[model samples]
Target: MNHLDHGTEVNPIKSNTKSIITDHNKDDHNAQEVKAIVRGPIPAAAVPDHMWQAVIANDRAYDGQFFYGVTSTRIFCRPSCKSRPPKKEHVFIFQHAEQALQAEFRPCKRCKPTGVRLPEQEWIDIVKTYIDDHYASPVTLNTLADISHSSPYHLQRTFKRLMGISPNAYVQEVRIQHAKERLRGTKESIADIGAKVGMDNVSYFVTLFKQKTGMTPSAYRENKASNTMNDVCTPD
Candidate 1:
């Protein structure tokens, strides 16, 4: 029944309590955000000393994290480059290969700081060959980058640009093709067949097979068998 000048009744105690709760929630959220910012990854450029040590050690772990351009040679290299380390005073760290290139530094032929600078077809050929050779093994972007001597980011972009499909999708296609051949020619168990094709998880393999071929591996094998029988029975 009580009303203020604007003609609206208010509970002062409840209103005050809600304001306090809202302030407390805001404070808690801000504290969490501060903690997250503090715990975030430190960018490679912030730690030149650590990067220097990585380069000196030829640590593969630091390969794509940063590159060091040597003023003496005007060349940039990944931290894991096998070439001899440049003098510390003459080296400058760059967060990306483009940054070094912008500074007029050419990519080191040894470390290949600027990936895929070769002829586009040559780069694609190298990637495709690596994929074909390692189709039966576990091939991931990082592994492919290491094998192909490029950053995972650059390798993925280049591969998708030229191949019309992501590298992983290409690997899946290769695996499925191999699986089909094995299914038609061999009497191997389904799980064994999957493992032979680099899909160790049988269920995942079955799922992928069905997705790719519109039928399960068992069904595909049965269809092949039925076709073989029909061919044998036919006079032609």
Candidate 2:
């Protein structure tokens, strides 16, 4: 008994003609003709159900197999991206990293889906630079992510993890510090000083100032004024 390891077994054909179709016949040669098949990696459309579930679970095993992007946010990530999972309906699957890039989706900073890696501290430093430059303007998580090339979710997570403060809190601290400078150096009205430091609402500014420094903006200004006077009155 002989057993073949590969290739398909061909069936014998019984024809009405006088010739018999056997392994030695031309018909057997036609049956043995093999068609070459070239197969590439499976596309997203053909991804298995288990693979999709792995993405939801953030299983690292599927990291290189596929990528997913949130259509609403336009950000792509590896299967094991640490960021919170987007709604399934908004997720668009990619066969590979390049496919996500071709769709104009930014790679997630946390996952390094696009292979462009920036250190965690470097990202935090970029965010700090943005905060320092835009402290006087409106600052939001989205704005920080836009300037730092990261997702708002990732930015907030990394900023909190590394800096021990939320982005919004950091911005408020910067604004309050700027307000302090304006209050001490200039004789401007408290409201104007609040406005100068990006706090348009004077009441809110006063409340924040008191919460942070235990003194109202007016009290801080008066205290500075008194200290200046004492400096002039006292002997050098």
Candidate 3:
């Protein structure tokens, strides 16, 4: 009776097990389809022609559809970014913001494709800090823009608006301040000091120092020395 029971039930059990396995396989296939739809397109896939046209036209309708990165600037932007259009050859398309970033492209400060907006004051502060650190070198609007990940026009406008002076003026002020310190504390020649502060032309340096301080470097040094001596002699 035990042998008969085992033989009679084995086929039915095998049929039920196969049915369950088939259902699981169907569920897995459906899950993969859903994941593929959510992930959008593969980044390595060839860019569709319509995407390029959308970028050129600055089409806001396609903004979430794709992103384009400029190889020249290494910056990625949404289709709706209003900055100057990049050359066709320099642009690479990505299906998502994260894909562009993963490819080493920084999100555009203008469009902010990553949805994080850096505060204007904070951006200006970063520019100022860079200038302070590199004032002894030639700092131009283009160089600052490149380092700060912004356009030169925007950088100039924002920096001047917040700092009360243009970037070039700020650079001159920094250099002159350093020149003044060297003049009072060190015996370096005026020409050498000028060069050390990034103004290599002796004539131009003297002219600029007088313009900024209302006295030549030599006169300023002399005045400082005179004041120090008088203070020492009249000590309480």
Candidate 4:
């Protein structure tokens, strides 16, 4: 397997603080929604000069959905900040934190543009909100980080450090746990349970259920039924 296949952000160019900036801004998602949803490393793209000026202006009239990647530091932001403007040569507009990281631009400790600095408690709480809202849909840490103006690496690190597991893992655990509950509490088929949990690979779902609970999903259902029956027969 290509070592690069693993989950870290992918940077095509070695870190080039000066040269990463370029002209031309076109992304498919810009027209689709008020907010962007990203799930992987930021793609390399061209950015125009006027866009930077628009950001410094914080022209809410100008769509900010794709403009805040630099809001946490020197690269992005309104032209209106009290501090002096960034050198034209050193500035580049990133659409997301993964883009900045791929370009090797460290977050401004002062601005900390990404929502990554949120306390673990707050981070988990927000993640729960995301899950509640989008659990049935296809979503990933990259998507969640996109909501926070940061990269998957930043969010994953903070989430793991605080929650003791990767965000993706926590999501999977939550999904599987929910699936198990439905399987035991309802007459839903194994396939329905899997689908309800955002899983479609019936075989893989069964395997995961077995791995996590030491029993097939069907067996788990049977166990739950038997327990209910025994409880009903016994007092209270």
Name model 3 segments beyond 4 Å from true. 1-113
lDDT of 1 by residue, 53-126 (tens): 87789987656656777765556788788766667777777767777878876676556777745565665676
Q: Over 4 Å off in model 4, which ranges?
A: 1-120
TM-score of candidate 3 against the unseen true structure:
0.56
Better of 1 and 2 by lDDT: 1
Q: Per-residue CA lDDT of candidate 4, range 96-154, in tens?
A: 66566666544432234554443556545666667666666776986767544456787
Name the top TM-score candidate: 3
Full-model lDDT, candidate 2: 0.75
**What local distance difference test score does each model get?**
0.77, 0.75, 0.81, 0.60
Ranking by lDDT: 3, 1, 2, 4
lDDT-superior candidate, 1 or 3: 3
Which residue pairs does candidate 1 place in steric collision? none
Checking candidate 2 for backbone clashes, the offending pairs are none
How close to the true structure is residue 215 of candidate 2, measured as C-alpha lDDT? 95
- What are the TM-scores, per candidate, against the unseen true structure? 0.54, 0.53, 0.56, 0.52
What would the TM-score be for candidate 2 when compared with the true structure?
Answer: 0.53
